[model samples]
Target: MAQVANLFDIIHLNKKLADKHIAAEVHLRDACGRQTLWFELKDVEEDTLSRAQDVAISYFAGKGKPIEFDIAKGINFWIKQF
Candidate 1:
């Protein structure tokens, strides 16, 4: 499927419109069996909300979710968590 984004839509999205955009994105990802695992987002470095990801990392880390990144084995079959 084609991912479409345009400047006008991005610049004009209010709270309601932004929520619709997020819901649509979630529906599309769910339809394709894609999930947003926390491991994949713990390295976010965006300018505005980078600290938000840090907060999640600290929270999950306190709960002991793979609190390390020492993966050495290559994925022979499929991609698993680090």
Candidate 2:
């Protein structure tokens, strides 16, 4: 059940980030604290991406799940979450 919840959480976060035009790279960690999966974002804005990360964390945390997201530097982010 927990694994499924985590999986859905990852999926939901990914979709939300994508919709906001923020390129992201998702790395799912295993129960043993090892990375198990990786997702890379396509065309996106730097500012939107950064803000998206913050919003995502908050959105997920509100759902009783907190996620860690890192945005690479030198990227151009223009869009805001609103």
Candidate 3:
């Protein structure tokens, strides 16, 4: 009965890129209304959406919570648990 957390609300791309790297930012908000920002980089042979997805998977998986993209309406975009 573990609680499921929303990944999208926590991590998002900043739409900025440099060379073969893409920028991703993490935003965390606690019940106390405190927030924090963390910047991350993803290196790829070539910048593409597919590579971005791969980077995201690796990032979250490292956190012990793997997720997959869901395109269905009302469903969380990142919705797999591991």
Candidate 4:
């Protein structure tokens, strides 16, 4: 909700400052095998979030679903709606 929106705002304003904020919230969105990695925050010229990020975060959070993304399992994600 506002949490992710505020993050986008900070990122748009200052990427350097956003790094600190993301680090702080790492614990909330992730554990050892974190999956809520929202957007690509590296080496990109564009300073905007992708459509995938916006829709997925909103849909998953709204439906109380968790997306489990695993690189080892053939690099895919599943929205656990069960």
The most accurate candidate by TM-score is: 2
Clashes of 3: 0
Say which prediction, candidate 3 or candidate 4, comes out ahead on lDDT.
3
RMSD of 1: 13.2
Winner on lDDT between 1 and 2 is: 2
lDDT over C-alpha atoms for residue 1 of model 3:
38
My TM-score estimates for the predictions, one after another, are 0.28, 0.51, 0.40, 0.27
TM-score of 2: 0.51
Cα lDDT tens digits, model 2, 2-71, are 3223567668767777676567755465644233344454555446545655756565567765444335
**Number of backbone collisions per candidate, in order?**
0, 4, 0, 0
Steric clash pairs (candidate 3): none
**Residue 80 lDDT (model 1):** 22
Report every candidate's CA lDDT: 0.27, 0.51, 0.42, 0.38
* lDDT (Cα, tens digit) per residue for candidate 1, span 15-81: 2223433221111112243222222222234431223223333533444442222244211111124
Ten-residue region with minimum lDDT total, candidate 1: 22-31
| Candidate 1 residue spans exceeding 4 A from truth | 1-34, 37-46, 66-82
Top lDDT model: 2
